[model samples]
Target: MKKQLLVAVSLCAGFIASAMADSRVTIHYPGQSQALVLQGAANLEQLTLRPELNGRTWWPGTVIAERTASGIQQQTQQQTQQQLLARLSAFSAALRGDNDGELAGSVDRVRTQLAAMRVTGRQFVPLDPDWIRLHAEANRRLSGEYSVYTLSRPTSVQVVGVTTPAGPQPYQPGRDVAEYLQTHQRLSGAEKNVVWVIQPDGKTEKVPVAYWNHRHVEVAPGSIIYVGFSSWSLPRAYRDVNEQIVSLLTHRIPD
Candidate 1:
């Protein structure tokens, strides 16, 4: 009877140990053919200190994809896309096919590019150990299958929304945001006075580009300059469309 009891207790301990084990995390570095797998990393602080991350020029916009949150993130993204498309269609209808359809065309191109992107539970958290140590939320315990992507520095800034042939433009160091806008011809119905700058760290800023209110806001490499539809041109019901677009762009996966 004593032997039987020992076997049962051992089985219970084994089950408890298995249940308490940390989930596996995969670390992907730029230009690396194989990913580094880590087990038993308790939190972001521990993961960032791994030897593999040493001596690398860490991009501040590093992404962490948590498997458990992926489904919810995907659903939220799809819903936002649908809402934006519906509003854009309504805006075009209000225009009665005016402005040579340039506004509608440009917006459609932006939406297409966004649609092609894969939606994941990507969290744009700063991987700097110092930053993580200061912010309790950033240092939270990690679980599930997490993919940590350490991306390389980008050379170009993407200029999209209400621009002809919306895409990437060469990023010039110390160039003002207005100068970048001048290079890209704004399509009809584009906002003239202010443009939105979405930086790689998932921060958004509204910058003035008009001659009267122009501010020398430096455009960072790997940022996105969005020249959205003029506020006056938007219908009352869809007045916040530009803001929504900026929010959605923040979630885009870096190339």
Candidate 2:
């Protein structure tokens, strides 16, 4: 009788262990989303999300950005893709004054980012696949899954001001913006030569500093938006926001 009881106990414990192992990976970024990505082969086809995001949620359809052992960039791409879908769904739902919980917050965050952009009128550019791939690559590197990444090269860092075109200008260290001031002391703000910068794209351009990208808008008359920058998309998954943003932005912009 004791042997049979021991066997029953062992079976119960084994069941519990299996249940725990089968639990989906939970990912959440407060104002973001709380869902599960199933544990399975990374190469699953039914879902666009990395192994973690495939079937863990009640998604209406396939999502984007499959996670990898690499960087959080996969999450960033997924965030953008999810935001896009949410926005479309939300707008249509407004006809009935309905708001889906998961999508509402995501769309709101996207709105806040857009409102912060200088080109307030410009709509959110559709998420690019190249951006998605680059994000995944960067995430892999930053997450230590990869040793490193070779940037395509710095392109242009265009600078603008409260009321001027700055016109695809070069990156300046101490001029328009002080974001990229380095240890080199040869350049001074008064020197027009000081603001010139070469970007990662192998394109020699002018700027006050190595501002990441060449797209920006002016905030009001005196306030300005830094150009050559990426849309600072929030990581919709659980991770460091600034770290993810900088990684995705500083990574080579998608081709």
Candidate 3:
């Protein structure tokens, strides 16, 4: 097995600044009614094929070999909001001021919408070094095992979307970055799983397996891979994760 490029993003939001020293963070998500203390960072892809490092940043998506009752689907923040809105549409109809995700086949639409944003845990009131408060305004009616919340304002999502009805967005890698790594090349067998790399655009990068040819490779923060996913991983997951959370304005979170 090789440490493929993985992007574990989103879960980094709302971390308690009380970080120890090395790289441990206690994240308190909305609807969680609890906090998650994760050390190091990793992604579902990396953790699936390698060892986990405590106290590091994390990644976003997971590459599953097959689908299950709970499979991950890539989605944009707008899509997430639209889906949530649709859930409560019957009670709160769009007064002709809606952007999308309305009308006809709502039941099936709701299921598909959730299926896409579904990570592996409860939906969250995404937080950040800055303060942002999202409430269970819309999805309150449909809340259950998977809690939900709505942003106070609009936000953007960066993860790449694949196999969408509209198809994945244009993802042409940058020439500057591509050329830089090509010139700096000096990796060996499986030892190359040092730090994962992700483009700011939200698309994931592989953990380059040029070193030992082993299955796994570790990485550094802001380098690559954010959070990890697996059977032994965290009990909860997050959907609609974004950068620079701006939902809660009551308090300012520390970066």
lDDT of 1 by residue, 172-216 (tens): 899988988776787777899999999987889999999999999
List candidate 3 segments past 4 Å from native: 1-60, 63-88, 91-116, 122-165, 175-255
Give per-residue CA lDDT, model 3, range 30-113, as digits (tens).
344565544432222222122222122222221112112343321233444454445434322331235323322332332343
TM-score of 1: 0.79
Please give the distance, in angstroms, between residue 156's alpha carbon in candidate 3 and its true position after superposition: 17
- Please report the TM-score between candidate 3 and the true structure: 0.20
lDDT score at residue 144, model 3, on the 0-100 scale: 12
Assess each prediction's global lDDT (C-alpha) against the native. 0.76, 0.31, 0.25
**What range of 10 consecutive residues in model 3 has the weakest lDDT sum?**
246-255
**Over 4 Å off in model 2, which ranges?**
25-255
lDDT of 2 by residue, 1-255 (tens): 999999999999987766543322224321343443344222222123443343333221111232346535455554554444454345435523553443333434333443232110111221222344556542221111111111122233433211123323343433334432332222111122223232222122333333454322211111122222122322234223323222222222221
**lDDT (Cα) of model 1:** 0.76
lDDT-superior candidate, 2 or 3: 2
